[model samples]
Target: MDIDARTLRTFREVTLTGSFTQAARRLGYSQSSVTAQMRALERQVGEPVFERLPNGVRLTHSGIVLRDYARQILTLVGEMETALRRPAANPPRLTVGIVPALAYGQQLARVTHIGRRLLSGVQLALRIMGTAEVHDAFKAGAIDGALVLTVVDADDPADLLGEQQYADRSDDLTEVRLQEVEFVPVTGVGRRPGGHGRQVVIADPDCPSQRWLPEFLRLRCDSPPEIHELGSMAGVRAATQSGLGCAMLPTALAADHEEAGGLRPLPGVPRMRWNASLILGRHDTRPAVDRQNLTETLRQATALGRAARPAVPAAEVLGGAGLGGEVLGGGATALDPDTSIAS
Candidate 1:
């Protein structure tokens, strides 16, 4: 309706106050100016916008709809004004969506530390979300980059994590594989390390290992086993500690528990793999300095746990095929470590 910012401002103030005199006073305008603007607004809308009672005013149904649209229009106008007038004054801001695996661990801390060092005067915002949320942020242009963890095969990198799963990879995004965290199946101490009696505890839905673990476990059982869907790795670890189910975790995260006699390794089931990657938008408007620093931050952080872990080959894990072939009912099959770490 060709309304100007001033008129919209007047309309907004009047809606807030529900009184022409109050709105005019709040806006530093005469009541006649407020009335003139409202009359003009009604003419543009071809409907009465307000019912003027003796005490105050009330919005018509049309005015309510216009109020909704006016709020959106005003917001966009404010953003445009800000962008045009103070583009250079904006801080080197980075909005990142990170999986809980990295967000809750030292890896994320390392990233922020390095990010501050590399991109001085940087406004770094870290969002702890799932793979799906990370993808959504990227799609919405709400985030500049992301730290994500996904599952893959050790022997065949492209074998796909379970059939028809979008949890591991997004087709259109750029995923920079940072490091291969060692994956080991763990059960509570003295619990059946392999299938059958063991319930499987997995990271939240869309977690890197969430789908892959269930598929591997079902291979050992005739039907789908009992599954606990935890929303975070800490929950998964806590559940594992309680001897609720078997979980495949990065050795770095599970090593201490295994060593402390609270958890033990499960062997014979195929060793799963996880890919810890930094996902960035293909089209980035970030300053070159900010983008480079973010990439470095993710790279350094993903390496946090991989370096300290001791490597255990497939053969050493319960003879590489369970204590006996009892779990899988197959001959000695050694599953190797090929995973990415996260809390």
Candidate 2:
């Protein structure tokens, strides 16, 4: 069957998003155009690639096979482009998206430095976005990659983006476990006196910490915490520091501020764990060895101190052979960065 690169990319986006409308939006195509492309592809292949459902579509057996081949072909195309490109005075750039939480603290500089070191001459562009927005940007081919959160529980069924078990390592895609952080509720020094208000400081709706923190409060308190939506991580931190409301934050960050008398942990609240991973698409134009080196550099950058309990390795976490595996449970988007600077 005759196939094309653009059509393959459309198919991959549809598979990733599980919706025609979303794929159309990502690819900047009209819904009718996306429909026509799929129809023509189906007619040529003489098989239904997608099992249509009311909510979304699922890949048929044939579609899964096709997806594998498409990935390989597109990966080769990316390699060829990298190999044949002429060198210029200005380096080719890759724009990577991260949530506000990741951009705070020292992570922005750390990642920026690491990206430059690992990729050498390539320019690294960092943009701040909500976690879901980051994923949407990736699907739209607007960004090279993103730092995303997945539940640590491998048995959970909702984590679709969780890495999958693979005997052979992928030359194209590279996933690196950066750090695992604990989410805890924090309140300003004045607010700690009573801790009685329903007001809860939160980031934008897309933030995972916002969702998780409220649920925790609902379970333990007689009344649900009032939602105070701050659009950015810095806003959340500032508001919480001023006693506007208690906010959920990383344990490390909370400790740093509590020591400085700016913020203190909320009484009678438990912390939850979240893992951060750098997700690179298999069809990304970067070289395989460079991707590998980037992953290693990230791993080293995020290494925890000896006094802290060791985070689960990526291999054991995903039930995969090594370095990569699909997350298989409910999706949590991003974690707040708690480092010295946050204090």
State the lDDT at 325 in candidate 1. Answer: 37
Tens-place lDDT per residue, model 1, 106-210, is 556777876665555667889888766766677787888877765432323232222244334544455555666656677777554233234788765666556
Expressed as tens digits, the lDDT of each residue in 49-167 for candidate 2 is: 99999988999999999988986786565545555668778986777777665555656666766565555556778777776575457667887776655555433323423423221
Query: Which lDDT value does model 1 have at 16?
Result: 63
Error of 2 at 132 (Å): 1.7
lDDT of each: 0.64, 0.61
Instruction: Kindly report which residue stretches of model 1 are placed more than 4 angstroms away from their true locations once superposed.
Output: 1-90, 151-172, 190-197, 307-332, 335-343
lDDT of 2: 0.61
User: Residue 25, candidate 2: how far off, in angstroms?
Assistant: 30
TM agreement with the true structure for every prediction? 0.58, 0.57
